[model samples]
Target: MRKIIIGVMGPGERAREDHVRNAFELGRLIAQEGWVTLTGGRNAGVMEAASLGAKEAGGLTLGILPTRDRNLISVAVDIPIITDMGSARNNINALTSDLIIACGLGTGTASEVALALKANTPVILLTENEEGKRFFKALKPKLVFIAKEPSEAIQMAKEILSP
Candidate 1:
């Protein structure tokens, strides 16, 4: 069977500690389930925290970077794909993953969620922001899911990934 690539999307520099911690535990759970973790290759906020969590659990990580400089890749990223596509890289993040886990809301995270929905990729939202809730309500139920905790999110992802 092919490897499952689980994408994690969330706020970067603007992420809150609670959201970051959620992403961290989510990543750890994903790793423990023997799935690969994917994130935006940035050193701040949820991106950094999730990568660290996955790495600490001995899981593989893939970073889809928006820059050309390899040295700028997140320290926790095991494989870095430099797109230099700026925010357009969000489309790549949505398309490449089998499913996406959104930890928090931000302009970037919102965009990634929309892109994933457009691409028919399933998305699990961990945070219950107004914008996310509104978007979730508007979308089809099969494509969007909301989880109150990391374990719940992991279980949802596993259910969606399973045949």
Candidate 2:
């Protein structure tokens, strides 16, 4: 089986309590589904939470970092792919992913979303509010699925990966 590369996009700071828990659950589910996780290599927020979850589940976690600094890499990341492309590397990361999960996000996350859309990779957004609804709606017919919880997001990703 071609390994399904799951991209997780979110901020670099510590996320809200709910988001942090959800991100961890999402990573666990992704590992359970036999998918590899790809994310930015940072120590806080959804990236760190998901990486840790995947690690605990015995899954491979790949970090696509913007610099060569080993100290900047997250502890949960098992493989670090260093690139000097800075923000431009976001597109490369998106291309490497077969599916993307967007948690609570920032500008960098937004860039990944755009790149995923451009690459025609399926994306699942985890958000419950009107803003998320509006954002998904605005991207009409792009195969961008939205879920209120981690399970739903993983389910959507699995469905997308089905042959």
Candidate 3:
């Protein structure tokens, strides 16, 4: 089976309690579905929450780190792909995925969403906020999908990947 690489994009800063819990649930759902997870290797917020969930579930968690230094990779990451591409690393990360899941995030996540859009990869935005809705609305039929919650996002991703 071709590994279903699910790109989990989100903010690196400290997240709210709800976002953290959701991230964990999202990661567990991805792992439970037997899909591979890809994310930026960082130690806080959504990245840490998701990676830890996936790892605990015995899922393959691939982390794409911006720095070439191995020590920069997050401890929760199972496989670290270190690159010196800086912000451009988002492009590589999106390219490695079959689907992209955008959690509540800031600038970095926005960049990943844009990269996924450019790549024509299916993106499932798990958000209910006006900003997220408006963002997708502006895209106007580019294959960007919206889901109100993690479960819906997971289901949408599965549907997109189904043969």
Top-TM-score candidate index: 1
lDDT of each: 0.89, 0.82, 0.81
Segments of candidate 1 deviating more than 4 angstroms: none
Q: Put down candidate 3 lDDT per residue, 22-114, tens digits, no spaces.
A: 777888889999988888987777887889888888888988888787766779898888887888899997899898888875778878887
**Which scores better on lDDT, 2 or 3?**
2
Best by lDDT: 1
True lDDT of residue 100, candidate 1: 95
Q: Which ranges of candidate 2 are over 4 A from the true structure?
A: none
TM-score of 3: 0.92
lDDT of 3: 0.81
lDDT tens digits, residue span 3-117, model 2: 8899888777756777778888888888888899888877778888889989889899998888877887899999888996788889987899998898865678778887888
Order the candidates by lDDT, highest first: 1, 2, 3
Ordered list by TM-score, greatest first = 1, 2, 3
Extract clashing residue pairs from model 1: none
Clashing pairs in 2: none
Instruction: Assess the local accuracy of residue 47 in candidate 3 as a C-alpha lDDT between 0 and 100.
Output: 81
